[model samples]
Target: MKKILMVATNVDQIGDQQTGLWLSEFVEPATEWTHAGFEVTGASIKGGKIPIDPNSYSNELPRVWDGVMEPIHDTAKLTDINPDDYDAIFFCGGHGAMLDFPNNNEISALLDHFKQNEKLIGAICHGPAAFVGNKDVNDSSIVKGIKITGYSNEEEQGTGLAEAVPFLLEDELKEAGASYESGGPEAEHVVVDQNFITGQNPQSTHRIAEIFKEHLS
Candidate 1:
């Protein structure tokens, strides 16, 4: 079986502001990939713990899913892993990632390494922001010319977290030189750019995972 690494944030808290990641992000994609016969290993920056937004995990969503759980309610934290061994790297988002993941030198380095090796990279919602930091060995933005999308500015504003998230995702992505474009104002759309797959919001999880599975195959 091909090995795939699943990366989710240890981020459990939403901004003093709003909730994100929504159970759909983890559950649908995880379940889909697991069902697709890929060997998936879930990991976070800190080993042993992972965090899910309390709000998103609630079963009110029409397609509510809750797949990504440790044997515990809390998420797990993983110290390090070999991105090289994995055929693809996936980042699951939550509001917490906006706070913890952006500055993780290790994640940035891993993304750069995976991107350099031309390995497939996956990021959803705020998770995609993590990849926004990757720079090529030449220092040029690796995603500068690529079409991509993530949590959009309008989505942030709608959630009243425009100020809570470190930076506006759509704006920041464009700043990083990505040819950023989102599906619609809603977070339910998915965008795939070759080796890089992105989900606009939690609702996009299922499609994103399906596309990832197709690409991995």
Candidate 2:
């Protein structure tokens, strides 16, 4: 069986408002992976309970909230996990990801390890924030020249958090040299380039998991 490390932000608030893991982004993919018999481990920057962005809660939660919340509620610290243990690593998104995913040396190092080993890597929505400053062995941004997609500036503006987020995800990825693409606002779009797979938003969650499984196979 393949193993996957799913990383979520511990940031429970963005300024005075609440923000954390986008519940559907994490839960939907996790449920799919679990049902497929993948061993999925959740980790956070600080470990412990990973907060969910209240705005992401939906009626669908009650149907899939059981087994999915365990790993999330008590995630391992990112520093404690060995990147070598998993076949792939997925960064879960939320507004909180913009606050903590970038500039995180631990995440950068783990991404480096996975890239060096030719292992799979994935992220969705604001989760691509983790790739902002991450670089390859050549010291070039890991996303440089790759086709990737994430939460769009339009979508951020729609949320009225264009200024609240640390940086616009689509813009940051482009700045890193990625050829950013999107399926417009809230449309499902998943980009698969080599070992890196990125989804555009929460709407792309299920498809991201499907593509990841395809690549794993």
Candidate 3:
């Protein structure tokens, strides 16, 4: 069976309040992957119980909660894993991802490895924050000139967190030379650029996962 390393942010603190994984961003895509016969494993930057966003609670499916919670509580430390073991790496997003995914050495290494090996790599919403630190073999940002989409600046402002996040995801992606695209506010937009796939926001999760599985096949 193909294995997928589904990563969630360990940072639960967003500004003065607490935020963590966006339930749907992680669960929706994960369900798609699991149903498609992939072994999906969750991990975090800190490797422990994953924090969750309270606002994301309403969409939870009780049947899969335990399965989702299992890996969150027993996450593998990034340093302890071999990238060679997985077919893909997916970064699921919440506001928390904006806090930790960028500038994380381990996350960067995982992304670089998967990209180098021609393995699938994907992210949704602010999850694309993980791509900020990844580079190509030429030592340039891997996203340079790549068509991609992520949680947009407009969306951030709409959420009233325009100033709260460390940086604007869309702007940072553009600065990194990514051909940033947006699906115009909460719309489902999934962009596939070779082995890397990115989704615009939570609404695009399942579609992105489905695309990833299609690519694998």
Best prediction by lDDT = 2
* Residue-wise C-alpha lDDT for candidate 2, range 1-217, written one tens digit per residue: 9999999999988877899999888888888888888999999989999998889986566766588878998999988998878999999999999988987789888988898898999999999999998776678788888899999999999998887777888889999999999999999999999789999999999899999988887
Q: What would the per-residue lDDT of candidate 1 be over residues 1-217, giving only the tens digit for each residue?
A: 7667777766555556445355567667777877778877777777555555776754564442344344224433544576777888888787777766664667777777778787888888888778656576686676777788898887889977777667887887898888887777764777777578888887787788888898888
**Which model is ahead, 1 or 3, in terms of TM-score?**
3
The models' CA-based lDDT, in order, is: 0.72, 0.90, 0.85
Better of 2 and 3 by TM-score: 2
What's the lDDT for residue 38 in model 3? 83
Highest TM-score model number: 2
Better model by lDDT, 2 or 3?
Answer: 2
lDDT of 1: 0.72
User: Candidate 3's error at 116, in angstroms?
Assistant: 1.3
TM-scores, each model vs. reference: 0.86, 0.96, 0.94
Q: Which stretches of candidate 1 lie over 4 Å from their true place?
A: 14-21, 59-68, 71-79
Report the candidate with higher lDDT, 1 versus 2: 2
Residues 1-217 of candidate 3 have per-residue lDDT tens digits of 9999989888888788779998888777777777778888888878878898887876546686557556666788788888988999889889999888887778878877887788988999999998786675577787888899999998999998788898999999999899999999999999999788999998888788789889876
Candidate 2: residue pairs that collide:
none
